[model samples]
Target chain A: MASKTALYDQHLAMGAKVVDFGGWDMPLNYGSQIEEHNKVRTSAGMFDVSHMTIVDVTGADAAEYLRYLLANDVARLEVKGKALYSGMLNEDGKVIDDLIVYRMTDPGVSGEWFRVVVNCATREKDLRWMAEQAARFDVALTEQPELSMVAIQGPEAIVKVKSVLNESRGRLIDSLSVFQGQESEGWFIAKTGYTGEDGLEIIVPEDEVADFWRALAEAGVAPCGLGARDTLRLEAGMNLYGADMDESVSPLVSAMGWTIAWEPESRKFCGRAALEAEKAAGVTQKLVGLVMDTRGVLRGQQKVIVEGVGEGEITSGTFSPTLNVSIALARVPAGTGDQAVVDLRGKQVPVAVVRPPFVRNGKKVFS
Target chain B: MSDIRNELKYVASHEWIRDEGDGTVTIGITDHAQELLGDVVFVELPEVGSDVATGDDAGVVESVKAASDVYVPVSGEIVEVNNQLEDSPELVNSDPYGDGWFFRIKLSDASELDDLLDAEAYGELCEDES
Candidate 1:
């Protein structure tokens, strides 16, 4: 069955090229992919991310449930409207998904409530996993199907968003610090994004999302699709869960060591034992970024070889539009970041290994 | 919008062949091939004067998404190579049949054109893909 988002009609009205993405009708692109990529780089671009799954966990045990479920501690989100980025792990300490959890302020409504947003492709599995965990606890978890989501990203996103709302709300939105959120009426505005840029992800009623999308489009925001979104995120060193890591890949090797909070020994989370064991024994393979020097595009599944270790596969690879170079994220040997070679058929091509984030905020992070 | 010129023949892998009106033939990839690959970031052209059998991998074409092998439509000897793609690989995406034509060859057998598909048949073959 093909599911339709609130912006489906709007996309059709704009003559977008629609495709089925994870069972939902999505706009692959309004027209030219290169044009959309250029728009996000030079100006502003908005994506219809309503296909993503949004869930709300309420009750006193909401934070406690997240602490037990997520690899990162949600107790660090002391300030209301602050968002935390964390990875959900399986029993083997392997990352199931990476998500952003927003702690909403509810001093009067119904107590402290937190909004959890996950990838569109992993919606069902994420919800199922979350529900199973909730069944073990007393947290009230509800999927937010009533609300639609959109992400306006890039350099000119702020300017375009500000033009839609009133001066007060506009200024309030611009005043939002990174990883912060605020609710105005039924609209939830959070300064969060996957693209390495200063932007915001806004949530509102389903019907209202189309209207908001129109207003944003009219305000000069380009309607970008999954193509540009993939390139943009890859250039930012962000991982797409199913492509970069899944239930079999651990965060210790997925470049998520900093996200794990280990201070409080009392707070034992799911997969903690395995992660500790892996940490103590040492992980052989780690995720690293590759910059191809041969001018050919690097793609996923391409073989990478270190001196001693045999071979590794490219987890996620793409041409970095921002850096104007072919880059890839690969799971190579732990000590292979210094240098590596990607097999271009029978020929071995030298590739520079470095910390990812080839580009950020419209600037090339790699030279 | 590239019409299959009557002088050219095509293969299922999306390469075109030209029966050079002699005992030789010329070959290059089709426009549809480059379109599927998006912009051509790199081209690994085969060595000139090398023996290329029919359906043999002449070179590799790398795009934003994946890298694919360009197969020889007919057995031949590489007579010409388009060094133009060495710097401006986008030409393959912009003009797969023209300036982006990968290479030309002097065929071991010009009668091999009979084994290739016609323009209309090639179009039908492409349209059938999922």
Candidate 2:
């Protein structure tokens, strides 16, 4: 049996096709997956992302602990609501998970408070790792399973989400800058989303999530599912945790090098020495985006043949509903060039190797 | 319940066949199959002049989620393939029984039709799988 989120009933009520996603019975789609993907690109769409795990870290040594535990420096967060995307790596430089860490308290507050949201499938190991790391510091990790998250994304996402909030909450939402999240009236409204669109990932208590979902639906926000979320994130060039990288893949080759903060070399974060060694040894492969202008869809594990270089495998691939093209992210040899061929079921089809973010802000971005 | 046309014959593999009564049969995936494979993005059809035996791999259907192999139900030479799907594969989801038909086959043996299932038997198969 699979676990159910707080919005599971609401999902079934809305005619969602439920599937097992990382031990959670979640909605794959309400109707057409492509339509749901388009909803986020064109109008507004809401996703019940309650299956993601949220861990609140608070203590006197919170900042110092996170700075050492994560690859990115949290001390760079100048404001309370600012968010940072970082890769949590193991001692050997392998990426354990990618997450968003938010500064939950004012800069000068006595004790540091931060909120981190990790992937649902990696909940057990992530929590265990955080706990083990916190043992040396004064930080306390609290798992907030009682809260549920809903991401409303698109061009009119902010307007639709604001319409469901009170005056002060709406004002707080309006005041939020990109990649910022603020708490208001027992809710955490963040102007951050996985989709490359203006949106909010609002976290509300379990008791209030259904009503909130209903209100958003009444406001014409289409109820999207995991399928749309995956496609939207892929189009946005965001990497999925398990698909793009795992415990065995190094962050240096997973297009996550930017997430590492190497400045202030004195501050030793976890996996720093290993990453430094890997970087010094010369990175071999890098993650790149593949575009198929021909027929058929690009799928994971498909062999990408780079003409004089070497072969690579697709990490994640899907038909871009926004661009009407098949796009993929693959880890190819460092010498791979602009064009390659994919063995799409015994047929070697040519593909263009371009930077990711195939679509952004409802428009085709890559040249 | 998915649409199960009584006038058509079905295989356990979720394909529906229509005996055109002219030594040929029109074949397409059942509505249930289309519903399971949501949002078809690409459809690979068998060549118009190729001969295939029963249970041979005839084509492919790639959805947004995954790809599935389309198998032939009866041995025959491929007569016609739906070209419309190359541009608009969603037809498989929107009208699986009609415009979403995969191909037409010139039947080599009409006796193979007896092995196919009726609407009721096909419905039971779908029911048991679910």
Candidate 3:
């Protein structure tokens, strides 16, 4: 039996096709996947992201503990309510998970409090890892499973959300800049999203999530599912934990070198040694974006050939409803060409390799 | 809104055959097969001159989500292939019973048509799967 979200029963009432996702009963889509995908690309859409595990690290040692635990430096966060995306690494330098750490300053959410939102699929592993690190630090680690998060995304996201919140609270969130979060009305509202769009992700108590979701939906925000969430993230060039890199891969070889902050010689972080070694030694493989010229859609684990160097495989691929083309993120040899071929069944289809994030800000960024 | 014309013989696998009254028999996948496959994105048919045995893998039908092998119902020589599907593969999703016909075979055994399921039997087979 899977744990149900606060909106689980409500999802069933809406005729949602519920599936077991990371031991949680969640909606894959309300009815049609293509329609849900299109809704996020064009207009405003809301997603029930309550399954994501948000852990709080607090006390005087929060910053030092995070520096030891994550590959990225949290000291970069100076202003209150600023969020930084980082890759949590294991001792071997393999990516444990990629998540966002929101620096809270309102005393209620931060000061001593630092929030990290991890993927649901990696929730258990992430929790365990955080505990093992906390046992070594003077910090108290607590998992707040009582909160529910709703990601309202697209060009009209802010407008749709602001229309529903309390007048004074709405002003606070509306005044928030992108990549910034603030505590208001006992909830943390962050202007962030996985989709390549302007949006706000609101964290509220579980009791209020269903009503909030309904309110957003009634306000003309489309109800999107995990399917669209995935395509949107892939289109943004953000690598998923299990699909892109996991226990065996390094940040240097993976598409996460930028997440590794090399500045400030005094700051020591986990995986820094292995990352520096990999960067100096040269990485064997890299994750690249590929757009299929052929008609068929590219899929995960499909074989990719880089000519003389050898073959690689696609990490994630799908037909972009926004781009109207088959786009994918592939893990190929670092020396792979501007042009490569994907083995679709028996036939080899040519694909153009370019920088990741085929689409950005709900528009095509690559040819 | 569905028509099960008596002139065409149906197979339990959802394949339909139109007996030309000549030696050659034209065949195509049924409407139910196209519906099960959400959207047809690509198709690969057997060579026109190749001899195919009944129940052998003759071609490939790829939908947006998955890929399935297209099996030949009756053994014969491949005569004509649907070239238009190569340009606009979604034709299989539109006119599956007509323009989406996969391939036509010059019959090696016309008696094989009698072995196929009729309209009533094919309709029942669809219900069973549901």
Candidate 4:
């Protein structure tokens, strides 16, 4: 049987179409997925993202261990509550998973703590990998399964979330900057979201999650499902762990070269040697965004022909609800130009190869 | 449970046909099919004044989740196609049996309708699939 979250009953009561996602029963949509997508773009929507795995890392070697384990430098987190997006790579410099790590405490604090949230489908392997590496370090890994998370996103998302919070919690929301998360009254509220909007991702205790969800609903926050979440993340140009990249795919070619902290040549991180060698040898493939103004949806695994350049396959593709057009991310030959054609159901349809982030703040940002 | 109109005939593939009593029939996907497809973003219909064979690959319906191939139920000449769906495909989700009708066909073999499932049998098929 698939596992159920704290809000499973509430989802059923709200007429959600439940599907098995990563061994857990999650809502796909309440009714119209397009409406849910529009709601997030125009106003506010809340998603029950409790299936994400939360790991607490604490020890004297917390910072150092993470700096070596992840591609992103942890030393750059100069302030408490600051979150950093990183790609966890295997020894070969291939991406294992993408995660957001938050510095939970100050640098000088005892048992310096950091929190990392990874994808639910990759939880077991990630935990095993972290422990295997921790055998040589002084860090401890603890999985917090007692927590449930909700992401309130869009223009009015913060206001709706704040309406349900107490005075001190409300004050905390106001004080937070982007990419900042803080614990208040047993809840971790962060000004971070997968959707390209000003919002909050709040981690609450399992016992309080249902009631909190109800309160947000009463405050006029639309209940969004995983369907909307996928489109939103894709629109924001964020990569899905398994779909965009895996252990066999290098981060350099997966649109994650920026996450590699190449500065300070002395600091050696995992997969650094392999990445450096690949970069020196000249990376062959690159991840780029594709836009289709014509009919038909662009789906994953479709062949993209770049004419003079080599062929590439789409990693993630869907119809953009905001722009009323089809958009996708594909791994193409590094030399590919701005023009390409996708073999859409046996028809070679023209498409424009552009930079990612097709939409930001609910507006089309891609030219 | 999805609503099944007793007056309409259904195919196991989820297409519903309504006899217009004028030697022609209106065809559309069933409500159960629309519910399964989530939000319909685009719909491809057969061209008007075209000949289609029974069980031929007719058109396609693209949803937010996936795409499904729409099949021709009976051999006929397409008399008219729904043009409103070009700009508003959500009509398929809003009114699957009414305004969402895909095409009207001048039946070449009206006997083909006998092979289609009735409302009761179609309900049973949906139940079995679920």
Candidate 4 ranges beyond 4 A from true positions: none
Per-residue CA lDDT of model 1 for A232-284, tens digit only, reads 88988998888888988899888888889886989999899999999899888
Q: Which prediction has more favorable DockQ, 1 or 4? A: 4
TM-scores, each model vs. reference = 0.91, 0.98, 0.85, 0.99
Q: What DockQ does candidate 4 score?
A: 0.88
**Model 4, A72-164: lDDT tens per residue?**
998889899999999999989999899999999987678789999999999999999999989888999999999999999999998988898
TM-score value, chain A, candidate 3: 0.97
Model 3, B4-123: lDDT tens digits are 656677876677888777777777777777766655667888899999988988877866456767888888999988888887777777787788888889989888888988888887
The residue-by-residue lDDT of candidate 3 on A244-288, one tens digit each, is: 888889887778988898888677787788887887888889999
Q: For residues B74-130, could you state the per-residue lDDT of candidate 1 as single tens digits? A: 887888889998887878877766788888888787677788898888888888873
Give the Cα-based TM-score of candidate 3 against the true structure: 0.85
DockQ of each: 0.53, 0.89, 0.29, 0.88
C-alpha RMSD for every candidate: 2.8, 1.1, 4.1, 0.8
Tell how far residue A277 is off in model 4, in angstroms. 0.7
Lowest summed lDDT across 10 adjacent residues in model 1 chain A is found at: A104-113
Q: Report the Cα lDDT for residue A51, model 2.
A: 94
Cα misplacement distance, residue A268 of candidate 4 (Å): 1.4
Candidates by DockQ, descending order: 2, 4, 1, 3
